[model samples]
Each structure stands twice: as C-alpha cells, then as structure tokens.
Target: MEALLKEAPKVNHHLDHMPNMLVCENLQKVYPTPTGDYVVLDDLQLEIKQSEFVSIIGHSGCGKSTLLTMIAGLNEISGGTIYVDGEPVREAGPDRAVVFQSPSLLPWLTALQNVLIGVKQVFPSASKAEKLEICKYYLDKVGLGNDFHKKATELSQGMQQRVGIARAFALKPKILLLDEPFGMLDSLTRGELQDVLLEIWQKEKITAVAITHDVDESIFLADRVIMMTSGPYAKIGDELVIPFARPRNRKEVLEHPEYYDYRAYLLNFLNH
Candidate 1:
C-alpha cells in the first residue's frame, strides 16, 4: 500500500493550477412541510476548482441531492451562498448544466431536437450549421449517433441518460452538476457510461460536481470524494483523496495495493 501510494500521482493538481469554479459557504437548506420546518443540511461548505471532477457520497437522505440542486441554482438556498466563477448564483443559467437521475428529457422531442435546444439556447449567435454540428458531435460522443432521431420515450433508460449527458456536455457549461446520474442503471451499463463520462470530461476539461452513493464509482471518477453524514442536518464528515493516475482502468486500479486500503478507509467512514 505504501509503495502504491508512492507511485500514485498527486491528487490535487487541478485544484492547485485552476481558479475556483464553484464555492459554497456555510450552505444550509430548510424545508417547510405541513408539519413544521425541517433542516436538511447544516453548515455545508465545499469548493470545486476549474476542470476538477468532484464526487460527493453519503447515506440516503443525507441531503446530497438537495446540495446539488442548490449549487445548480435550481433550488434556493435557505441561508448561505453559492458562487460560480466569483459571482453569486441567483438562478438557473446556461453557465451551469445538470443531468438528473431520471434523465429529465422531454418525451415529445427527439434526441436530436433535445440536444439542439441546448445548443440553440447557449449559442444563439452561432450559425445553424454550427448548432447542428455541436449537437451531432455530442450525441456521437455519448454513443447515441445512430439514435439521434429517436424520441425520448422510445429509447431505453440508459440511452435516455446518454442523451441527458450529451445535452449537458453540449451546452459547454462552466460547471456540470450530476445528481446520481447512473444510479438506476445495471452494473454493466453503468460501468460503460462511467467510462464514456470520463472520456468526455477529459476532452472538455469542464468543472464537475457529482453526487453518488457508490464508493468505487466515486474513487474511480473524482480527485476527491467528499463524504457527508446522514441528516436532519447533514454536513461533510471526511474528504478522501484518490491518488490514482489519469486514464484509469477499473481492473488495473483494483490490482493496486493502495486500492483496498483506500476503499476500506472510505467504507469505515461511511459505516461509522
């Protein structure tokens, strides 16, 4: 394990070089149900650097989704602030694109049309050919080239999720937010999508924040895995650094001596 740690590359290279792309300061979220006020998150603070990929994990109902929504500016913060590139996040904008667990595609629109919507919205000044090229490039990147004309409802769950990913990447947002985007897929399909996501992220170099429950997935994808505690009031419990080199492979990573130690450390943290 010590030898593997020595061999592993530095974990925070992107953070050291890139400017802060997103910052959350003492973030909190409260809900007013019919019964009373409920606190979902408490004093949650996080930072994501430009071109960094961060994965957040915790027990169910740990406010993981709530935190992502708040960062995406889809949900209002109860009391705190989120800044994207030094400016406060006031509402949803093209600068931040999100891919939800359900894919959230418009059933009425074809996959090509769905991607075109994001391209048109983000690059209205560009010519029609430019928009079409962007849409086609992303759809093909996500392994949806042959199905571009298919409607959302006609595609499988995994295919629909691919469209969602392609659309989010097509927008070329300053930050990409994912809320358990692969949680519903089977193991084989999920692994395939993860690889595709990594390829796209490396190509685009976009900042990203992903909320997931899978420990191995987090370790494989993120430079750092931020773990939160279960909530009525959830907060960050630990941050695990993944020192594995880029262009990682699941088989090779598992064979490394440090893999078990790192996995065990996170498992202990989560189980405790």
Candidate 2:
C-alpha cells in the first residue's frame, strides 16, 4: 500500500490559490438495509478550485457515482454537506448540470429542441434569439452544428452524446458533473469528444468533476486525478496532480516523462 501511494505532485500555483468552487466535507452516505444499515461513504473530504478539472477514479463499487449524484443534488447525502461557490447544496439547480453515461436526450425532440429545453430552464429571461444562439454555439462547439434539427432517435449514439454535451455547456453552469459521459461510446468517438470537451472547458473555465473508469481519460483531461478507496466506506485514497500544461496536446501528454509514473501509481492502487 505504501509503494502504491506516490508523493503528491507539486501543486500549480495558479490553481492552488484559487477559491474552491466546490467543497465536500465529512460527507456520509448510508443506505438502510434489512440487515441494518450499509455505510457507503464516510467522512469523505474533497475540494475543487475554480475552473479546476478533476477526475475521480476508484475501484468498482467505491461509491464514485454516489458521491457525484449527491453533489449534483440527484441523490441524498445522509450526512455532511456539498457546497458550490460557498453555498450548501440542498437540491438540484441550474448552477450544476450533469452529463450521464447515457446522453438521455428526448427522442421526439430535434437535437436543437433537446438543448433548448435546458437552456430555457436556466435562461428564462434571455430573448428567444439569444437562447437560440447559445444553443447553436454550443452545438457547433460539440461538432453537431449541421444536425441541429435531427431527432435524437435519428442521431447515432455518439451524436446523441454530443447533444448531451452541448446541452450541459449551453446552461453555462458554475459546476458540471459528468458520470462517465463517454462510457457508452466507442473508443474513437470517446477520444474525439474528450478533445471537444477539453476545448470547451478551456474556453468556459467552469469547475467540473467527472467520474471515469479510464485512467488515460482521467489523466488527459483533469488537473487533478482523485483516487477513492474501496467501499463499503469509501473516502479519498490519494490525489495526483497532472503535470502537463493545458491546452493539452494528446501526443505530448502521452509522451510526458511523468505520465507512465502517474499511470503506474493509479493502477497500483486499484490492483493492490
């Protein structure tokens, strides 16, 4: 276990001093079972700074999704609190938008309509023309500009996921939660969207927390890779700072001197 835990990397001065955009302190999630109670997470602590991209990785059933949904206000937190921009999270709000494994687009709506539903919710006061431009801008950013009117059902799985990404960003959220957003896509599509996501994040600079199983994806995208301990009482196991500077180049990041070292450390934690 000691060998698996590497020395924490040097923190970036720019991000280190930024105010925390999201804070999770002493978080607890308990599920009542017939046998009694099952504790899923205990005293978990996390803090993400403004515009920081953090990737969460853990062994199967380590409560990664549980933590994420609670932060998004989709699931209840049995104890403790999740704070965004210094306010406690009590319920779901537009300030936080989630992109799940399944894009979950409404099949009957055109791709543009699907995005408009969310945009309208968050920007009720914006003019019709403004809303249309926001949705169209994000859809174009995600590479779906030409297919705006296509029904969700007519789009490929990857295209549907693109719509989901477009919708999430169109809300201009303070924090974004992604629960394996590309988990269902093929490798090719997954990689392409990863770049698209990064480009958008670079421009928006919104704080985001993403749960992923792929180590490579985690490393390539996040400023910090947060590793969680195994459940039935999962907590943060360790945190590793990604050294490559952004806007990150995939080839350069893959060839980075510390890339393999970071990868080995992560794999060690899961394997041991």
Candidate 3:
C-alpha cells in the first residue's frame, strides 16, 4: 500500500499532460409523467480528467442511467451543462461512445458488421480495408477474434456484451460511458470483462465513467467512486478516492486490508 501511494505522483504526472475530458456542472434531469413531474437528479457536478476511470453507484431508480445518458448527450439535461474538452455537449457524437446493460446489437448483423459500422461512422474517410482492420483489431482486443461472423442472436449474453464493448472501443472515442454494462452477467464473467476493460482503458488512455451497483466492481476499476443518494431527487452523496495502485489485480486487491473497509463504507452509505 505504501508503495502504491509512492507511485501516485508518477500517475498524476502522466495524467496532467492529457486534455481536460469531461465536466458536468449543476446537472439536473426531470421527466414529466402523467401524474407529476419526476425529478431524477438535482444539482449534480462531476469532473473526469483524461484517462480517469470513475464509477458511480447508487440504489435502483437513483438516476444513474439518466446521468450517463446526459453525459453521452443521448438525453437532454433539464439544467446545467456537460462539457467535453470545453465544448458543451448538445447531442450524441462519435466522440463519446456508450455501452449499455443490454448488448443492443442489431440481430441481423454479424458482430464484425456491428463494429464496422461504428468504425466507419467515426472514420468515414478511411478505406474499406482500413475499417475492416479496425473492426478486427477491436474484436480481437475483446477476445472475440473467432466469433466475428456470428449473429447477435447466436451468441451468448456474455459474448453479445463482448461485441458491444468491441464496438464502443473500436471507435476510439474520446470518452467512454457505460451504464451497468456488466450488471446482468454472472460473477465470473463480469470479473473477466472488468479486467479486459481495465487493460483497454490503460492501453488507450480513454476517459471512462461507469454506472454500477457493485461496490467491488467500482473498487476494482475506478480511480474514484461516486455514490448517489436514492431518488425522487438524486444527487451525489459521497466521493471516495480509491488509493489502490494502477495496473491492479482483482485477486490481490481483494486481499488488501482496506478493501473490505472501503466496501463496508460504500455499503453503509447506500443503505442509509
């Protein structure tokens, strides 16, 4: 643990050179149901620096998905602004890619085709061969090299998720937004994918904000964990800095003394 703290300065120095990635200030969201206006979030603020990994955890119906959608510009903010690299986010763009809990793939398309569509959208100037290469590269990165030709319906849930993950990363977005991407998977598969995501994030230096319910998952992958209160009007409850070392191993991290303590703290916060 002491050695990890000593290495922190080196990590910070590396991060300093990268661009300011995401800033959400006083963000609010409200939905008008037939009965009344539903206030999902209120006055939320968060900043994710380049290459930073942030995890948001909250009780069900706490607006975690709403917050992620706002960041991705898939949904409008009722108030406040989400800025990516100093520009206000107005609509969805290739710069911010999202992976949802469901794979959300086109059932008719092969996994390779699904990824190729994103590559082409982001890099329209690239030749056919270039797009194909990019698709293959990302598919292989997600450990799906042999399954590229499989249709979405043919693949298992975990494999479908691999395709979604591949498609999101293939675009090489400036920031990655994930809304419970692995929440539905079994424990063992979830752990495997978490490691895969960490490796990709490390290698690409991509900024990431993930919404999850699992405390251990957040601790394993995030530099910081932001917990939200339960809603009618959800807002950030606490921000916990994870002092774990970079290039963390899931098994070794679980063995750390502070690991259970942090887990207990988050669990207590959520319950309260």
What clash count goes with each model?
0, 0, 0
Q: How many clashing residue pairs are found in candidate 1? A: 0
TM-score per candidate, chains pooled: 0.94, 0.96, 0.92
Q: How does model 3 fare in lDDT?
A: 0.87
Cα RMSD, model 2: 1.8
Candidate 2, residue 114: how far the Cα is off, in Å:
0.8
Which residue pairs show backbone clashes in model 3?
Answer: none
Judge candidate 1 at residue 138 and give its lDDT: 95
lDDT of 3 by residue, 1-272 (tens): 34433433323344566677999899999999999999999998887788888899999899999999988989988999999989999999989999989999999999999999889899999999999999998889889868899988999988899899989999899889999999989998999899888887778878899999999998899988989999978998877778788788987899987787778778878888
Provide the lDDT at 70 for model 1. Answer: 89
Considering TM-score, which of the candidate structures 2 and 3 is the better prediction for this target?
2
Over 1-272, each residue of candidate 1 has an lDDT whose tens digit, in order, gives 45544655545864687788999999999999999989999998888888888999999999999999988889989988999999999999879999999999999999999999989999999999999999999999999968999999999999999999999999999999989999999999999999999989989989989999999999988888889999988999877778777877878888977888888777888999
Go through the candidates in order and give each one's C-alpha lDDT: 0.90, 0.91, 0.87
Q: Which order, best to worst by TM-score?
A: 2, 1, 3
Evaluate residue 257 in candidate 3 and report its C-alpha lDDT on the 0 to 100 scale.
74
